[model samples]
Target: MDKIKIDIMYLFGASGHGKVIAEIAETCGIVIDGFIDCDDNKKSVLGYPVFKELPSTTESLVVAIGDNGIRKKIVDNNIDAKYPIIIHKMSTVSKRTLLGAGTVIMAGATINVDVNIGQQCIINTNASVDHDCLIEDYVHLSPNVALAGNVTIGEGTHVGIGVCIIQGIRIGKWCTIGAGAVIIRDIPDGCTVVGNPGKIIRKMND
Candidate 1:
């Protein structure tokens, strides 16, 4: 039998998160060329070589790091490389939804109609974003998160696992919503909110 050849894309980061993203790519039947990481000592990830520099031959890249700031920074630096939007085969995304480049919609996630998800975002396993929600760039929606209709999550925010945001809530940029918290009102930028009816536990220093 003739060898089946597949075009492979490059992945950035070689940590645990990178391994997860590579698995997702595999689930989608996409082949990964290898990892392009800054760490010289890191040799391989999931059997694929970790290259200090991305090969010129590969045209596409995926920023797999979980940190919002780092993900944004990497994408900003590699704007010339093609960033493919990756959606798990099991995830249900509406036809009307607009997903930006390098976003990963993980398995069992459900994105309702007219949702706008920005670049390099992570919609993790079993998360649900309801109708008309706006998820900005580099946002991380952790596993099992539920966002009600019309919720607007700002850029670079991290919504923790099992959190629920009520309808019409606006979470500001660079904020952190702690695990299992229920967001009932607007959260200001750079604040960390936690507990039921989420309250600002602390505001991040600029």
Candidate 2:
């Protein structure tokens, strides 16, 4: 039988998040082909060649930008390509958990049983999602963010670094939970929340 050849995967963005994903891919024994970025001035990122555009015949790619909106835009632009779910070797993901395409679980992240993480999401370093949590598409859970059991995070939401949400709380779509914020109640859609108890500082229309 002839052996099947595997094409290398490329990481998009070529920034800090891209570098981290490169390391994680390397740890998983997956060779990174290179990086594709809009910035044409730079040559390489983390020793990998940076390309202005995705190479011809490119198939697999992962968006590694930290910003949720930028990542969403990049994924939307390249909707035809294959987006693989990359989980760091150091992270703990429950067998019952469901992770969608283009989701990256960074080092030291812990996802308990029955967690559902949506497409193009970022479970950043040292983050923890307790049992039965529902995290929607394009959500970014920053470093050290913790979510209790049965919590639901809506699509395109950005949970900031070191923030903590209480059990059974529901956070709506396109919301921004500020860093170090303590969420004690449900948050509405398209709002910017900050401080303890996670007050709504600004709405999307403002």
Candidate 3:
């Protein structure tokens, strides 16, 4: 992706996930201007002022929300906003890896060679994405989740914390892989998977 020259950076969402994104920006030596939150009750985050609207000046923004659907919604609503790729200083990303705009790679995360991660996705703290993995838009690889080589995670899927997927497995769109589940085979779209060797427990409504 092309480099985004940000004069100032602001994070959208002022909660726990937003705090972590703020630290990632600070670790990267980027100063956060403030946080933009919809909640009027949130006066500030991490000592930075919280505003209800985006500043008029040219600035980059990162959607700091954790939910895949909501992140996608925010990105869609702000189509003209500049969304930069935010990678934590401690994360290891390959030179050949292709990360889309607004994707955040958190501290201790490792994205191996030939990985293609789409926009507004979150490779959360300590997540491991092995080589040749294709993670679609708005997906969330939660902390400590592991993916074997050649894994393809479809759009809007949330791979829960500590979940493990074997090589060459294709997880379908909008699926929810529950925490600590072990995926051994392909998962269908809109399914909610759980347990070891992950079994589809239910299908989510469209």
Which candidate comes out best when scored by TM-score?
2
Error of 1 at 70 (Å): 0.3
After superposition, candidate 3 runs with Cα above 4 Å error: 1-5
Q: Residue by residue across 55-165, what tens digits does model 2's lDDT show?
A: 987889999898888889888888899999889989999999999999999999999999999999999999999999999999999999999999999999999999999
Writing each residue's lDDT as its tens digit, candidate 3 over 1-206 gives 23334777789899999999988887777777899898989998889999998888636889999999888888888788889999987999999999999999999999999999998899999999999999999999999999999999999999999999999999999999999999998999999999997999998673
Q: How much lDDT does each candidate structure score?
A: 0.91, 0.92, 0.92
Deviation of model 2 at 98, angstroms: 0.2
What is every candidate's alpha-carbon RMSD to the true fold?
2.3, 2.6, 2.9
TM-score of each: 0.93, 0.96, 0.94
lDDT, residue 112, model 1: 99
* Stretch of 10 with least lDDT, candidate 3: 1-10
Over the full model, what C-alpha lDDT does candidate 3 score relative to the true structure? 0.92
